[model samples]
Target chain A: MEITIAHLYPELLNLYGDKGNIATLKWRMEQRGINVTVKEYALEDEIDFDGTDILFIGGGSEKAVRMAANRLCEIKKKFEAYADNDGVVLAVCEGFHLIGTYYKLNGEKIKCAGIIDIFAEYTPDRLIGDVLLQSSAIGSTVVGFENHCGRVEIGCYKPLGKVLYGYGNTDSAQYEGVVHQNIVGTHLHGPLLPKNPKLADYIISRALKKKYGSVTLSEIDDTLELQAHKYMADRYKNCVRKKNDDDI
Target chain B: MTKIRNSLAIVACKLLILAGRLMGKKGSSAPGSIAMKISPGVLRSLASQIKGDIIAVCGTNGKTTTNNMIDSLFSSAGKTVICNNYGANMLPGVACAFISRASITGKLNADCAALECDEASLRHIVKHVTPTKIVVTNLFRDQMDRYGEIESTAALLNEAFEKVPEAMLILNADDPLCAQFGKGRNAVYYGVSEDTGLHGEEAKDGRFCPKCGGELEYEYHHYSQLGKYKCIGCGFERPNPNYSATRVDISDGLKFVLSYKGSQHKLELNYRGFYNIYNIIASFAVYETAGGTIEEAKKVFDDYKPQLGRMETYKVGGKNVILNLAKNPAGFNQAIETVCADKKAKDILIVINDKPSDSTDISWMWDVEFEKLKSANLGRLVVSGLRKYDLGLRFKLCGFEGVVIEDISREALEGIISGNGEVCYILANYTALFETQKILKTMEDK
Candidate 1:
């Protein structure tokens, strides 16, 4: 089945090489010999979302996010329906905020998709720095950077991960990201999939399972990708230990 | 009583800054932060009460150097000047300088104040200072995480300048993006002549005009977006610069003849690269417009040196390491060009951290001309940082063979320095530069 990646505002949401998320998925899926046709839909584009399997959105500034909200509100129902039927969805950073229940910016409340229980509010201080995440579902500690002024509430429902370094939820151990079934939302950015290859393959495997049911070769690809991620993780762990020991 | 009180306040401010520095909060605006905490409206009131001219220097690159040069020029001309030479360009930093210099009654000490303002902080500070002059060096896509785009920033600057009442605007004529801001204002333009053979091609995407959305025509690019350009639709050509570097010969560090007001004199700069030449011309123009004597300008230009870790040379682990800041693709590409121009094989260590300040988005690496790194004399490339392996992948994609990756930034510097003695070029972003410098300093003590 073809993957339809609906990038909310590829131009605006792509401040942090966030477009690399979609590019990484396309290349890796093609590597697994899947017949993948990716369609990129942006704001105000008249396109049917009926056949879209996977949707992708990334990050942007507060002003850009509000501007995108006003535009995406036009097609909010279409996006909610796509995710409600278990269609794969990946929203990151500002897009993650845009897909939430409500986003408060500049003392104004803006409506979002509201499919998830996540609520985001802008703060005086900007959460801008490197972030490490420990996720139970992915079974690995992932690292990336977070640059935003808004604080997100994961609603005590479920979190994709918890922050290891930078601020995320602030209430409980810096909880990070949101994952509900086939839908995954997080702040892990840029070549986001390259750093989390297992997560990429996992999303692909789930989509395949939902569509084709119990594929063997896809599982094999998932294992290989997991090994690659584990190798990098081990190297990172070794480096951290050496650094802490002042060996450098 | 007033003198004693002013001196006490200054001492307190200095002590706070010193403590902040010792606590590893370098560039932390301690004085301003403290003053604001103590008395909020004092800084704005003091700035409004100042007698001398207020010049705000701002841009992505060269703001520190340009501010330093202009400050030095003003001081050399027998005028007391106050400036933040430590690259603290935020609101609090700007306030810190003014606060420390102010009298007990909140009156300023210096005859003039030249501040290096960050582009993002321009709107907030401009609301207070009401500057007499504004100098724009150049515009490039730096700090995507903070400032959105070239146009978004330019719009903010345009709005800020609207508040100032008839200020002398010093602009870089070569930069089409910055030059557009000089429109409908009392402006003076300064740019490098295409005489320097070092004038190379710009990054293709960053060269467009911020206004009109039309393809910008360029006579020649000094580096990145700073070049002679004109819009096709509106005939916005490079304005006949009030001050221009007529004969720029950059073969041996930057040396150029600056001509203004029917007089031409040879100007020598200690800094290298085409970018530095633009910086020199900008300083000369602003100084001359602000009533600087020729002798004072020469003395300041000759005496000034590069800031810390920006083309700063040092000895580390029995080898010579040149530490330079290369935050963006344009800057990194130019710095690599400067290193390659030395015509000697050099060992290099490059740190690429995807920190929020260093741009978590590393896609701009694809735009950098890694092909220019194929100089014959370059020996080893030790890539390290948070995204060291990713950078190594990019280098390999650019056909770099035998790249060693050490994901940890601390070891990467030591690993590269531990190698055989060779001329080394160390390139790092904002945070990594400090770490690299600290590591090299520690190595020296041993």
Candidate 2:
């Protein structure tokens, strides 16, 4: 089975290298011998969410999110079905809000996919800079930057992961993302997947199991991939962690 | 006492710039993290406390040009329009404008204050002053590092406009994102007419309309998404413009006949390219909306020459070289189209730099249609800059061969500039623009 990545709004939701996440998923899946087809869906092209395997949305300003709100509403039912069926999905920053519970974009309630129970409120102050995300599932930390004015509060559903670095909910470093079944959403933009390959490998591994019953990376490139991960993990060990007062 | 403190601040800021320039440091006008620390509301309140009209011009591109044009046009109209002409359109520049123009008694002397601001800064700027007028030139994909998506930018502008309902807005009818601000607000839309030759086929690449999730159809594209588009699903389309360009002729730079208020005014401009034509049309709309007669705008527009670097023509090494700004794909294409229309064999110099502010995320370069250059009757293309290899790779992918990829060494750059070419075109991004200018300046100096 092939995973189809939808048309990413590179101009609007690309505050960071958010598209890197899409590229990472594609490369990782291909490395495991899983076929992946990526298509470009521009503003003029028609979108059929039924054919899409996974949807990737990036971050943008609240205005940009609202501007895209009407379009998202057009594909709302199909997007929710994609998430409900345990289909693999990833949305970051503004993309996260598009698929989340509700987005308080521009001081108005815009309907999102509501796949995850998180309410995003736009704050005058933006949480801009690097962040450290500690995952209870992986028992490790991932580093990325968050440049957003919207604050997402973890409500009803289980938190995706706890924020171990920069601010998540405007003032407090709490939850960083929402993970329910196979649908994963977060605010870790930048070259997030490349910077943290474990997350990339994990998503690919899970997707492969569902597709082919079992998956395997070639033994020939095993050492190289392992070394790359160790190097990246070491590089981000302390860079994005919640800083102590003395660390300043 | 307040005036004394503000004066001290302005003088100190100016000194800092001088010192940074003297030391040859890159950040001469770098607004430190401290500037961001101050809230936009506090800043606006401070500026409003000072007497005068506050006007802001914003968009993905043309903010600098339109803001500068507004300053020039208003100044030519004999109005004291104090603006930061050096592209310091952030909070600090607004602060500096207020500090510099205010009297010793703390009262402002200007008839109006106009500033060009970045798209991201619009939200912050709105907190400070309810501008008398706001002009959005056009919105295009620019500086992806700062703004993620075009829709986000539209949302930010919409929010900013919510606070400034009293301010009259001038928008681009061709740009759906910018034109959306016209909804339920006192807004005047200015855009190029559908009469301009429309491209038969839309670009296979670029952003989609946020409303329909379908390919946004443009009646006539003026580079990128700055076109008349109507979404098939929602019927969301270009808004009716208050001031429209009846006939846009781009033989040299951008010249157009603006139809507004029952009279057509011929706007002849030295600034070449479709981008500048849009800018000129927007400026005319703003001027007409501000109660200026078409005759008054015509007199001012005719005298308006090219700014420092928008499209300054110069004689370099006995060859005519036009220096144009091409920061993004749309801007670059507009610049290329302007030169290609000349019908003369022209030598092109394209520079791309992936600096921090220039955005190391260089994926957008892939979206630029380099194949358009096939129609450009050109002698040779001298490609040089930090990302020379990337540009060379892109050209190679686009099937561009024999294009000279030279390192941006002084001797090599000068050699390319002074080479055997009838016409030279220099296209530079943010990092390389000033350096290219400095090189040109040194050549003219000799």
Candidate 3:
């Protein structure tokens, strides 16, 4: 009857309206007559994995990322075990980089949670634009914005989807995100959920099924959501958008 | 060769401006880029010829308004001033403004130049012209894909200011990201020392101390990261501003008491929105700093009509249509506050364009505290522009029902204006501003 969501580093790792994901999840669940409890964990606070349904970690500044990553390094095993069970974790942009092994900063490696087989390094050529991703995990096209200077390396792991347009995980990888067990990671941050209701529902259903086994979430009116997603996705069909200096 | 290139660039730029004017284009940037392509050192050479001071206004919000205010204050004093007007605040626009004011012989005779400098382009711009006074309005997270992050913008600003060490910085002391630049530098600060209690939950990009990365503590916030704040770890705090505004009031227009040089001056303006208070006070600070008296600044500000889209008013179909440009969350949140302050029944039409100038990523739309708008005093809520559906979806998520999506902006305007004699407030992003303004103007007073 009730779902508890944990937002890790809500204040520090807040960027690009990534907190909208939690808001979207909360609003959707509350509309279904289900009670929702949101647990927020700041820098020095302890995280409770037991009975927590969904976990969200957003992007932050380089310093915040370094500081948060170092703080969470000690308890990374708890995160791995949490995911190994049916607990859902959603990480975006710098959060996606946080679950990785290490973040290379100017030839110096800063250790992260190291729960996933992913690594990221700083790049001068920043990948930034409105991106469209065809995600098989949610069985729909995901549309959002990707702005990052870190080119990720997903070593020997299946990606969430192939990049339909814009830069993805790596230029050669042509992939967008990492999907392992109940963990979902992506850099598409239009906050990555309000526009793509199916994916938001997907993350919710997984959490619900884990708690109240084989539960089906009722359908809400998503015409506006799908309209927003398809509008941005269809714009990228024949065109690859890049930021041009002269365009400004 | 330098003289010849200057002559060619100047004449060609003038010819292009004339042609653009003939074609009904309010051209500002394109001709400047063409001139820069011809003469690379044009901005520096022209800027050096200014008889008075070259003041550059840089920040996320209030750049255009502050720069324009400075322009009006100096020009009203009968000084030959050259400014990049109409929100053209990049390197090329600065070049074009100088070229527009240049003589046919490729020499300038301006007494002063008020240039609005874009934050990301400041480093490259400083390579050309060193401003005599640099006014940083405030820092905010704008165009995430373009600026990358707020910290990167602070770094870019630092790199530029380092190049022009002699240029005195007029900073917003209340902003932790901005005031950090004044440390150990020949700079003065200006801010609203009194808490106006007007606050929004927009992205506070300056939450951490720029000095030591320690989390900052706030006594109260006037708005997004701007107010009385101090770092917990480092002793760095909001410096007592050399010029500050206190006793703020925005109930009807703006009224505040300005404090500077150990004297208190009462200041009032016919402007809405709490954010414009910063623009007015910052302009007054710059005006006084550049050797102008307070009386002249106040005289000009009292009679000042805001530049297009800064609460511009039009009457169509017997409805007052107010058009303002709200690009980012902080700006949008303030605009929403203005609308919510009005007790009169009003219909709100939001046009969100995803043009590259608007930074194709419209994700920031969700960041605007749209829920603050009281549904009680609201009429039909319509969404338009290229990214209308996206904003509409954001509304849908907020549990708003009966949302209208009219792609054609003109009809949206007409639709809102025709309804039940409600005051219509048309808000648009970058590219949609001009179009909405033009359509509103055509539909006005027929």
Q: Give the winner by DockQ.
A: 3
Pairs of colliding residues, candidate 1: B174-B227, B345-B377
Angstrom error at residue A5, model 2: 12
Model 2, residue A90: C-alpha shift (Å): 13
| Per-residue alpha-carbon lDDT of candidate 2 for residues B117-216, written as tens digits (9 for 90 to 100) | 7667776667766688899887766765456456667777787888778988898888777776777788888887765773422222233555555456
**lDDT of each residue in A19-109, candidate 2, tens digit only:** 4567667766675666888766654457666677666777665545665666667766776777777677777877877777678856678
Give the per-residue lDDT digits (tens) of candidate 1, residues B23-52. 877646767766665655555676776677
**TM-score of each candidate?**
0.71, 0.68, 0.97
TM-score winner between 1 and 3, please give it: 3
Q: State the lDDT of candidate 1 residue by residue for A99-169, as single tens digits.
A: 88889877778887776777788775556545566788777777665666678888766777766556665
- lDDT by residue (A34-126, candidate 3, tens digit) is 899999998888888896899999999898998889987988889888988868989999999998989998999999997787899888777
* Candidate models: Cα lDDT each: 0.71, 0.66, 0.85
Which docking band does candidate 3 fall into?
medium
Off by over 4 Å in 3: A241-248
Q: What is the DockQ of each candidate?
A: 0.12, 0.08, 0.64
DockQ of 2: 0.08
* Candidate 2 colliding pairs, count: 27
**Candidate 3: true interface contacts recovered:** 0.64
Evaluated on the second chain alone, the candidates' TM-scores are 0.91, 0.90, 0.97
